[model samples]
Target chain A: MIRITTPLTDDVIKSLKAGDSVLLTGYVYTARDAAHKRLVELIKAGKELPFDIKGQIIYYVGPTPAKEGQPIGSAGPTTSYRMDPYTPALLDKGLKGMIGKGKRSGEVIESIKKNCAVYFAAIGGAAALTAKCVKESTLIAYEDLGAEAIRRLYVEDLPLVVVIDSEGNNYYEIGQREYLSSLK
Target chain B: MREIHVNEIINAVRDLCIEANYYLNEDIKNAFLKSRDEESFKLAKDIMDILIKNAEIAKNENMPMCQDTGMTVVFLEVGQDVHIVGGNLNDAINEGVRRGYIEGYLRKSVVKDPIDRENTKDNTPAVIWTNIIPGDKLKITVVPKGFGSENMSQIKMLKPADGVEGVKDFVLKVVKEAGPNPCPPIIVGVGIGGTFELSAYLAKKALLRPIDKRNENPFYAKLEEELLNLINGLGIGPQGFGGRTTALAVNIETFATHIAGLPVAVNISCHATRHAEKVL
Candidate 1:
């Protein structure tokens, strides 16, 4: 597995390819459908965003409330496609990576290529295991959104697979097709 | 006549929500263990192993098995002889959901309105289904349904001419299209017959059944076996990496329908199919 950190540089994203396994560390910002919509609205309105988007990775997640002395609870990626509408705009702003489960739309994939970004898949239904990777988390924006609020997270060696890379190659398509064909 | 206090219902549901989210149903855990052993694809087996380990961590640590603790779905089999007291039945259930979500620290996923889109914050107003039965006992089953697989579920309104083949083909199509989205391996819940809405309800209810149990109807039992085999053959595998275990089971529930329409609803639940039940 390749080791990478957040605030990914364009060169680092370009070096990755579909199907490469990654262990992502450092930091990522958490947001989901509601937060993404609001972020896009802020951009359109020419207001300053809550954080710097340059070379940052946004994880599509809405974590549960943390118990006493815990940074976060059951932090895992949500479905990615729900954020598809606002993704191209985020990519245009230099967002280099996205961590979530499931497929991205054709338009979003095109943005990944044009913007030198990558989409990573964290294993779905493995939240407890994934939570082990999150060493620290704090609410950063839209706290009224509750779980949907944007949070900054510090991660260590979080397991992931490159689903779609800067070149626009998709592992979900190629991997499943090859595996299904092999069975025949 | 028997009576149940609303407070009791609230407390029971509160505890049910917590228990269901933390504990992987024994049958589902066993299924994962069995699939891990049976899978041929190394990646698929690896995913299964992770799921098994995740369940253990959730149980031991008192954490939700998945981050999407899910909207609570309460299925109530209330005895006709029992009267609920102290408050409105629905409100009491919602109160239970409120306390459960807050106390358990589960994610509050409910939106106030689909378009307006504000967090309800308490995860109240569970999707409750009530059935009147013949005993003095009330049975409450709480299933916390994560939406990743829920969004992938489908419903079909088939003409009488479509028949069984149509149902089978449509199911396969849904599974094929869902491919990687539902976080396979998944449990396939098929609701056959009934009107449009009832069919969907039956399909959702079918998911609550134990994976090892087969339908009493011989024909449907055979169909379940056939569909399970066909789904696994598709090689969607665990987490859609491809293997011999695309689905853990196919469960079908049927009800009488009108002459003109045959509705089939398929509700898919992912590996974290967390459900708990209690009788009061």
Candidate 2:
């Protein structure tokens, strides 16, 4: 498994390949459908984003409210395709990685290749286990959106698998094909 | 006639919501363990292990098993012989949902309107489905449905000529298109026959059945096994990592339909297919 940190560099992105297991560390920005819409609207309006986008990973999650003494609730990746409409714009602005589950649109894949970004899949529904990786979480913006609000999370050794890499090699395709062929 | 108070229903619904979210049901946990033992691929095995461990953490820590504690779905089987006193039934259920989400620290995922898209804040107004039965008891089942898998569900209207093969084809198409999105190791709830709307309802209801149980009808039970094998064959293993355990079970529920129509609905549920019940 590859050990990587957020605020990723071009070399780190390029070195990864589809199907590689990764343990991601450092901070990741949380945003879902509502937050993404607002963020994209800001980008279009030439307004500054809530946080800097360069070299950052965006986790598509809207976690449950944390208990009194916990960092966060059962935090797991939401579906990624829902954010497909706004992904390219973020990629264009130097978003280095995305952590979520499921497939991305062709347009998003093209942008990932163009911007040299990566897409990682967290084990979806493995929320309780995943929350253990989150050391801290602070609401960054859009509190009215509740769970859909944007929060910045400090994750330590968060487990992930590269689904789509900088070169646009997609593990969703490669892994399935390999497994099916082995059965034959 | 038996007299049932609204507060009884309210309290039952409240506890059901929290209980359903925090504890992973034994049948599902066993399915995970069985799948893990049977999964050939390393990654798929690892995922099953994580899911198993996640459930343990959620239970032991008293936390939600998944963040998308889901939009609350309450199914009520009200007895015809019972009289409901105190307040309105729907209001009581919604009140229960509100209290459970707030008190349990569960995520409130409901929006007031679909298009306007404003969070309801308290997760009020649960999608409540009620049926009148012959007994004096009320059965409440709460299912907190996460949109990740719920969004992947689909329904189709087929001609009577389409037959069983047609049903199989549609199920495969929906599952394939859903791919990794619904979080594989999914539970496929298939509703065949009935009108367009009833078919969808049956599909959702089918998910309430435990994974270990098969359809009561031998023929339908056989079809369930066949579909389970075919889905696993698709190589969309756990989280679509590719293996033999894409789905833990394929449950089919059917109702008599009109002469000209055959409506089929597929409700794809994630590995955390959560539901809890209390018969009061």
Candidate 3:
């Protein structure tokens, strides 16, 4: 497995490939359907974003509320496709990486390739295990959105797979084909 | 007739909600272990291990297995001989959901309006289905359905000419299109032979069955096994990273249909498929 930190650069992204397992450390921003809509709206309106989009990863999740003495509740990636309509805009703004599950639109894949960004897939439904990697979580914007609110999280050794790399190699296609052919 | 108080229903629903979210059912856990051992791909096996461990953590910590605590779906089998007193039945069920989501620290995922899109905050107004039964008992089953899987579900209306092959094709198409989205290895609940709405309901209800249990009818049970094998052959694997375990099971429930119609609904559920039951 490859070990990588946040603020992914062109060189780091280029080195990664589809089907590579990754251990992601450092900070990632939490955003889901509501937060993505707002972020895109701000960009479209020529307004300042809640946080800098450069050199950052966005995890599509709306986590359960943290219990007493817990940093966060069961935290894991939500489906990524729901954010597809707004992803290209974020990618254009120098967003370095995305962490979520599921396929992305062709448009988003093109943007990922053009912007030299990568898409990571954390194990979907592995929320309790995922939460253990979260060191800290601080709300950044859109507090009224509740679980959909943007939170900056410090994650350590969070396991992820490179589902789509900067060159636009997609693991979903390649992995499935390889497995199916192996059986034949 | 036996008298049943609304308070009992409320409290039972509340407890069931918490229990369902916090505890991963034994059937699912065993399925994961069995799949993990049988999975051919190393990464797929590892993914299964993570799922198994996640369930363990959720149970031990008394936290939800997944963050999407889901919209509460309550199935009520109310006895025809019982009289419910003291409050409205729907209100009691909603109250149970409200308390469970709030007190259990679960996420409130319901919105007041689908179009207007405002959070209900307390996860009220659960999607409830009630059926009248013969006994004096009431059976409450709470299935907190995560939208990650729910969104991937589909329904199709085929002509009677489409037959079984048509049903198989439609199910495969849905699973293929769903890809990695619904968090495979998914459990496929298929409802066939009913009208449009009834088919959809039966599909969802099929999910409530234990993964290990086959359909009671010999024909449908065989069809279930066949579809399951075909799905596993798709190579979606765990999380769609590709392997032999795309689907853990395929459950089909059928009902009488009109002569000209064959409506099918495929309700895809993630491996974290959760539900709890209580009888009062």
lDDT string for model 2 (B171-275, tens) is 999999999999999999999988888999999999999999999999999999999999999998999988888899999999999999889999999998999
lDDT (CA) per prediction: 0.90, 0.93, 0.94
After best superposition, candidate 1 residue B80: deviation in angstroms?
Answer: 1.9
Candidate 2 Cα outliers beyond 4 Å, as residue runs: none
- Where model 1 places Cα greater than 4 Å from the true spot, the runs are none
Q: Give Cα distance to truth, residue B243, candidate 2, Å.
A: 0.6
How do the candidates score on chain B by TM-score? 0.99, 0.99, 0.99
Output DockQ, candidate 1: 0.74
lDDT per residue as tens, model 1, A28-77: 99988889989999999989999998889999888878899988889777
User: What's model 2's lDDT at B274?
Assistant: 94
Q: Give per-residue lDDT, candidate 3, residue B25.
A: 86
Best by lDDT: 3
Candidates' RMSD to native: 1.3, 0.9, 0.8
Candidates sorted by lDDT, descending order? 3, 2, 1
DockQ of each: 0.74, 0.89, 0.91
